[model samples]
Target: MSNLKPEPANAPDDPLRRTLLKGAGILAAGSLAGSALGLAPAARAETSAGLGGRLRGVQHFGITVQNMDRAFEFYTEVLGGTEVMRDGDFFGDRIQNTLLLTEEVRAVRDGVNPVTLGIPDLRSGAQRLDVRFIQFDNVVIELLQYRDKEQPTGSGKAFAPAQDLTSPAFPRAMHVCFYIRDDVDFNQFVRDLEAESARRGMSNVKANRIVRATTDEQRLGASLDSNTNRITEGPSAGWSLIYCKGPEGEQLEFVQVQGHAKQVFDGAYESRRKQLGA
Candidate 1:
């Protein structure tokens, strides 16, 4: 007789059977909820296909700043960005509704006791947000400045203390990364960044030493590499990178992709160009 016993039939106690039953129950509940919500069949199908089916590429990213003029000067002079538009003095019922600022939020902003509203105090206190769009070569950034309705312009009272984003370990800390143009010398670019900061009296802006991904392991582990399509030993096997701080201590990263990496990037760019018929 065979030493191994035949696998038992999938009973209710079986782990795999339990898991399948749970998954089916969840799916059935979701389908029922969708039907109750009057979701069209096509809409349900689209949802089942995932959000990527309806979503397009990124439009822009936003960063809140203390001083609009100072931030604008730093971005344009130091990093080479163009001013796109500016809008401000936003306040009213419509704006409040759009921002989902409830009465509790408004009460908190107005320095009212949240206990009266039967809720905890909300952190956001800005009466309005002034926005300026800056366009870089590859991306658009929206710079937002919160304003207090009662405070005078440029009084600095409207702004909150800056958060410490110096460490990547900080929760919600984010950095913008840019690619250096092929024509630009990577070493010279770092030198220029430091020089510009000093010349512009931006003491807060600082750049670290360049780091090179030279080994196959390093290339494979590069930030841009996808898990499914990693760059192991391609012509763009390695890359040069630098980390810097913006005037307000916002982290910035620059990369110059080398070897097979560049080839891969260029191929994608060409595909996008062809898709756009440009």
Candidate 2:
């Protein structure tokens, strides 16, 4: 999805936050919210404190969504994400899938939308993000949307290139990524994406690119002060990343190359956790 400023530890919860968290990327609140949200640390501390072994692999990813209901419907009923954790939206006063750990959305979404409309109007549902969230499976996936966003950006705009193939379902500058297990099927999955996009008249879906990252870029990532994107530069040696965009100028990132993604995470997470001493 998108990333925003880190949440303050003392920042009290608010209703308007629902809009802010949607597509804000840096969600530090709500279900599954990370350190960005106060509860994540508590979850980690609760788990870590009790005692558990390191994970063999990532179990799930956390992301923001616009229409929690529609997303839930699409994911659970359509994609088959077993309901994990869900609750009410503090702001909208509506029921939402605050937390849903799914494995299906990761395998589809982009590919399916394209098939529904081949070379379709890039503006259609492209940027209309009704829902967004993370998925769980053999691999982890993150889905994002623009239609349901009500979050205040202080002042920011989506950037879309003029000549990029226009899409009605997924716009430019908007992006979400799926983290594939090292052994996850690659070719077969691409075929699935292609087939779905083609079926929907969105043959243009094949135009999308699949990128593989390197661990070197992950370590080389620039500091938090990196740039306007708040993106860190790759370490020049250990890791790197891949970037893609959907319709309406949403940016998607495949972060920290496989081998090196954890380098910085280890240092940063450890340091932050120690700082909190939680």
Q: Which structure among the candidates has the greatest TM-score?
A: 1
Tens digits of per-residue lDDT, candidate 1, 70-140, equal: 77778877788876555454544444444445766677688987545433111333455455666665456
Candidate 1 clash total?
A: 5
- Local accuracy of candidate 2 as per-residue lDDT tens digits, 1-278: 23423331112653225433442332322333443211144223434443332222233344444334433443454334454332221212111222211222432554554323322121222222222343333333343332312332211222222335434355432345544334534433444433553454432232123332254244224332221121235553333334433222234443333344445555565575564444
Find the 10 residues in a row with the least total lDDT in model 2: 92-101
User: TM-score for all predictions?
Assistant: 0.59, 0.35
Error of 2 at 255 (Å): 5.5
- Cα error, residue 76 of model 1, in Å, equals 1.4
Model 1 segments more than 4 A misplaced:
1-48, 93-126, 150-158, 210-236, 265-278
Q: Best candidate per lDDT, number?
A: 1
What is the C-alpha local distance difference test score of each model?
A: 0.54, 0.34
